[model samples]
Target: MALTFHTGEVGVSRAEVTSIVADALRREAFTEALVATYVWGKGKRGTPRGSGPATLQKILAAEGLDVALAAAVTVLHEHGSQEAYAALHQQIPELGPSFFTKFLYFTGKTLPPANGPEPLILDRVLSLRLRSLAVTVGRETGHDPDGSVAAWVWADWNWSPHRYGIYLSFMHAAARQLAGTDSWPSDAAPDLLECALFNSAWEPSS
Candidate 1:
């Protein structure tokens, strides 16, 4: 089946962005550290092109890991045109060039697992604090935050050529956002991988 394309420019407001970013930070305590990720999935297998990955590496090689980490998340939140770009470029020849490639450059290499699921084909993460704010924004904007935001981590191991590379997929609203870890005792002690902006408003399709 052919895919549908969204015409006209899609824009988001700065106030909304600030609200979303702030909420993501407030409700959820910023993660002190998250294990580096690695790609593991099915799809084309080829070393990144000339100076492509290298350029991205240098551009993103921030002095502080925290800045790098935040930038990573920000990229996802902003340039999440993976699906759209793929579909549109086919029709709009000019847009087909290297949009995806550039986007990937902005994103860095996925690191190896931290020590959780064995075949963690994908890992979608989000800040618990952001959940409330997103929910609030969604409500105020008449848009569904759950529908708009979420993480997608994927790895494919069945592609014809490259069969052993980590792939990240945007898993829509599929993370479990908890409070904190167990050993380290504190007020918020639950680990949240994903949390919906507002649970009451969202109902599962039965």
Candidate 2:
């Protein structure tokens, strides 16, 4: 089996990508807990409560924290993505790319309803795995995979409307490929694929 790329290109697919995610989802342990945290403001062991950045801060905040920061977080939780981004930009101007992207993920997860596009988490694990897949495809095809889609993600593109659109498009493509399959849970193709990629990247080496 070959994993399809954004440009309609194909690379040899690793079976473990699907298998690990499927196995994890079948157990419904870690994955379910994470989903619960995202859907509801409930913490699970190491995972904190709240899905959005500000909401997450509010959930994790201790007693007698900065009053202003707490107020800002409350405002961020109440608004949509654009407002949340603006709030984050003003509050945490020094935040890095990863934080911004994760903020987007959490915002998407919390704001959207069940039938909406499942938020794809673009953390270090997922990014590294995606780059590795791109490298594999490049080696096989003798063409640099640092094209638009790959560059937008792997090159650390900033969070913008255009970048977010590209990211959603890529996830939607992957979801379409994995749709209507029993490899994981139903109606969660994108997230299932993302979990598979993350697990394959982060799994301990023997």
* TM-scores, one per candidate: 0.19, 0.45
- Estimate the lDDT of model 1: 0.27
Q: Let me know the TM-score candidate 2 reaches against the reference structure.
A: 0.45
lDDT of each: 0.27, 0.43
RMSD of each: 19.4, 14.6
Can you give the lDDT of residue 139 in candidate 2? 59
Q: How many backbone clashes does candidate 1 have?
A: 38
Q: For residues 54-77, write the lDDT of model 1, one tens digit per residue.
A: 333432342453443454344434
Say what the RMSD of model 1 is. Answer: 19.4
Candidate 2 Cα misplacement greater than 4 A, ranges = 1-91, 113-118, 145-153, 156-161, 182-186, 201-206
lDDT of 2 by residue, 18-129 (tens): 3432343345332322223333222111122222444434433434323323332334346443443344333433333344444344434433423334344554445666
